[model samples]
Target: MMTKLRKIILIPALTIVSLSGFFSCGVDRWPEYAHQTALDTWILDIMQQNYLWYQELPSYDDVNLFVEPASFLSKVKSKQDSYSFVDSVMATPLPTYGFDYSLVRNPDIDTAYNALITYVIPGSPAAQAGLERGDWIMKVDTSYISKKYETYLLQGTKAVELTLGEWKEVEIEDEEDGNEGGDGEDEGPTMEYRVVPIDEPVEMPAARIVEDNPVHKYEIIESPVKNIKVGYLMYNSFTAGTKAEPEKYNNELRSVSQKFKEAGVQAVILDLRYNEGGSMDCVQLLGTILTSADRLGEPMAYLEYNDKNTDKDATILFGTDREINLDLHSLIAITSGTTMGAPEMLIRSLFLEDVYPIATVGSSTKGQNVATEQFINEEFLWSVNPVVCTVYNSQHDTYGAISPATDLKVSETTIDGSTNYSEFLPFGTFDKDGKSERLLKIAIGVLDGTYPPKDDKTPEESATQTHFKVEKSVSSPASRRFSSKGLRL
Candidate 1:
């Protein structure tokens, strides 16, 4: 009986294996193998086609005909020592520099435009003329408000008159009453006030950075909305210092989160606008901390092949093992075109797991959801270009889903450097004529619990009951019941 049972099980297992093998074999051929062979053949063909005089000479081993030892020796002796040459080049001192902090512009508001301030250094001549921020910059010297004038004004060195609002050229001098009031006690410096709108723009100092200087720098900006604080940490790139590790990234994020919690911050906005992606390990560590326990072991994404080639083609990927229990009070992760690689993964993970609803206000994402491993030929040091290790979000369902969750599109009309949040809200993609202001109003109404939800009755239920015809825009994408928005219930 046992022998029969074993035979029965083994026969079915073998049959299934055979079927799987047959099915897999029927799939298309591996593209990488074909690609590599084609590339090699093309290279050889090109080399043969463009045979130079150098190739006409005998091989290196054919010393009898090709070798010129005397000439080669002479050439070597004529050149400087390689070690000495390299050392001399490396020994040169680097230039010293510093950054000017006089002028400040809101990065979100002024995308690429660097609006200059005409404020000179404290000891500089521009400061002597007096220039400050918020002064309505009319013109530099002789240039008017035109584009050419703006450019010319920027080029000018002389002082420019800035019209100050209301309080200008006002100074209050203290008068001492020496006989009765100031006779008993020594009166210190009295209160003095001065309001002067200097005509010239300030010539700010040049910006620079020291080679290996160690200086702690940080910025604290209070959020316009109540109970929200934004802390922006800008690092040039992740591969900066030698000792920088995964813990460094984790510690920084944890410290910021702790501070936010202490400050009673309702929401934390992690501004990674300038952060070019670094170590994947570091990104994983961060994700672990930001994510919750329920989502710890869950598959963040799968990395599989498009073709049914081999078992090695499949890979099940997951976020780091580290898990944080703390509530991730809404994460406002700011991203731009520059954000790529691991940064993109970080943003995607945040959205996928519902850790924090992402609101990408600026621009679209740089869609590079693939990781690769490089192999170099040891003898020639010629690298076989990156072998794709894993394709991200390979589940096929969420491959091209890197768009923003809120759908709050940002443009020039919505953004300004002023504190008017209302202005920002009342302007989005809803108004094609630039006058409708419908989307913003709708958003505001929704937020205020005033926008009524659309009634979506089923066909079967409607058929049973008395139905009335409803006039709706048929052209709108949102009209379909099972639309992309999934808002219709």
Candidate 2:
């Protein structure tokens, strides 16, 4: 009996040893590469530790992971000492509410507080009561609207009665006196009208015609010098639809381009002044269409990574699986302090190729050149800011740094139409006088050959030709003196 029991235990022990050996061999065969240098090891170590804070945070598996070996290694070198890496990785938008409203002001009633327009829809109670733009709204049932803040409560579709303090309708009245031929002076009679709230289409700016279709609203302003027309295409955001959907934005852009071509426009000015940024593919597509063929194959940008953790061994990855060749010569992008994300990419690509940046105002770029791939699971959405590729200019400068070809300092007055030019400085402290305007004028000058060449003029002449001086404002105790251009007191 002892011998039989020994055999049974031995058989199972041998089987377990065989299974362990098989698994160990298989694991050894699996590919595992180590870092080349101690610096690389250290970077990986830090990234792994930092990643733990976000591991349990959430895991999203919607999209496949994309790694660019070159960009990964480049970033590791460039951002070794920058604090922005940590801040950028942690930045997130907090949840918040968004509200939309329209306001109409009235000047007539003592209790004008009650003259708030509520539920004013066409063919509804308000429209039926003859309430229109500039009509004095007195009362919404029993509520009073003294301050603008009170109008927030009347947002949804709800019926409410209103009372008008007074309404004036301009009309001609006949004089009871028979002496009609004598005095020519006549005052119009005023009438009162009331209305209730109802749903109506809000009137908005009409979309202008580009090509044959009415699309992308734009303005064609004549250049200060003749024969050149500046076509301003104000693109707002690129978030129109997903990748699978047809690109409506491209359609609009094509239409705009066709119109520009038809109008014999010599140079186009793409105003990305307030653009925050959106889809990368959209930007790329637009670049393809706008750039010339000669500017296509040159290096557009270089990507840098903080850690060299990619398994791929290639230096350059192009297209899909490194198959797509990017064409970069199609656009001249305008950047401002407000330009960020993919918009920065567009500008950086142009800058790398030595394309004309035209005019950049406001502040320096936000400097977030890394790409992100988003993942979504049942529980949460995970957006991983991965250093996929280092965007390099033709010279292979990686760290996506954007110094304006011509820097312009933008102030609030610039956007409000009060200032003609921005100062060409980073911060608002330095005054550029008309430097911003000069840069734009020079860009136009380059295309037209009207601007004086640097070789033809002395340094002082070049400086004088580009600079415009504004008189300094005098400061007083109560208020500062304003410019005489009537830019408002």
- Cα RMSD (Å) per model? 25.3, 20.9
- Model 1: per-residue Cα lDDT over 245-322, one tens digit each: 424534555565466446554433444433445444455555554554456655554444223223445333345444
| Alpha-carbon lDDT, every model | 0.34, 0.37
- Candidate 2 displacement at residue 52 in angstroms: 14
How many pairs of residues in model 2 come into backbone collision? 36
Off by over 4 Å in 1: 1-250, 264-266, 302-326, 353-356, 372-387, 394-398, 405-407, 412-489
Off by over 4 Å in 2: 1-216, 239-244, 304-334, 352-357, 379-390, 399-407, 412-489
Give one clash count per candidate, in the order shown: 10, 36
TM-scores for all candidates: the values are 0.40, 0.42
lDDT of 2 at 180: 62
Query: Residue 425's C-alpha lDDT in candidate 1?
Result: 18
Measured on C-alpha atoms, candidate 1 has an lDDT of 0.34
Best by the TM-score measure: 2
- Span of 10 residues, lowest total lDDT, candidate 2: 480-489
